[model samples]
Target: MSGRCKGGKGLGKGGTKRHHKLLCDNIQGITKPATRRVARQREAHLGAHLRGDAWDVAGLTPSHLELIYEEMHGMLQVFLENVIHDTITYSEHAKGKTVTAMDVVYALKHQRHTLYSSGG
Candidate 1:
């Protein structure tokens, strides 16, 4: 506590837990101005300007297509599962046991979608 920053009780009797210890470190001492390289790295992650928007057929590879399809399929599966989960969780009886195919079927029927349309 002797060498610690002023105005905060040290992590001890009547003091905040260790989780808040960092808050006692004065921001002036903790923060530094960013170097040019760090700033450029951050910009590269986010604000890189688009190259010419002309038809980039050269970029369209089968692997890229497959990757896109895989990501889309994974997202669709997550959404469908969420819908089924919400439906089951909202029900009184179905909320208790392991969700079965019958439960999903009933939910989809009530929600007016086919089993395949439910995607599970």
Candidate 2:
């Protein structure tokens, strides 16, 4: 049997095993923050890129933003899994043996999301 992994790496059987391990790690957030301070710092750094007028600072407190970010992160984790599963299904049906960019595009379309490309 061909031992290629879903993401197209072709290191044979060991690659397949490693791919599954990586996928599981990602879905389980193996690198996620272990404390509120880390989460807060991440959120603050993300916000630092915004313009001075980008947000109404008086509106949302740091605590509120942290909770919102936490919720958003959880929702995105589930969405990410769904996307991966759909892409795998699409690739398998096409008999391609690997998930390609088009497979991801179609998978997102199946999930009711469209990705736009920018002209260079």
Candidate 3:
């Protein structure tokens, strides 16, 4: 009965139509290249600050160091996601494709500049 329809946000409760629309909207668009580019730049800039000689190049302030570390962590997460995406799209059917920590290490060494330039 209508009395049981306690609708509003979230699951099978109520507002079911709106929830379905929201889900569709979320899935409708492809990820934008510009957005990915911005993410890569942010990561790389933060990375530059976190490197070993950064403090010597630019005096280390405690807060600045913490901020750099936080940015680096976020950038690493984004980079990892890209790596996973690339593997899924390009090598998925190649057989026995596994992404190990070493895979990330190798990818970073070889692909970092290219990925940054192209906005991966």
Give the CA lDDT, 0 to 100, for residue 26 in model 3: 31
TM-score of each: 0.32, 0.51, 0.33
lDDT value, residue 13 of candidate 1: 52
**For residue 16, what is the lDDT in candidate 2?**
33
| TM-score, model 2 to reference | 0.51
Q: What lDDT score belongs to each candidate, Candidate 1 first?
A: 0.53, 0.68, 0.51
**Considering only N, C-alpha and C atoms within 3 Å, which residue pairs clash in candidate 2?**
none
Candidate 3 residue runs with Cα over 4 Å from true position? 1-58, 95-120
lDDT of 2 by residue, 3-99 (tens): 5555654456334334353344353453334433445555676777753545433588789876765675677678888998999999999978677
Candidates sorted by lDDT, descending order? 2, 1, 3
Model 2: lDDT equals 0.68
Looking at model 2, how many pairs of residues clash?
A: 0
Distance from true position, residue 110, model 3, in Å?
11
Best by lDDT: 2
C-alpha RMSD between model 2 and the true structure: 9.7
Best-to-worst TM-score order: 2, 3, 1
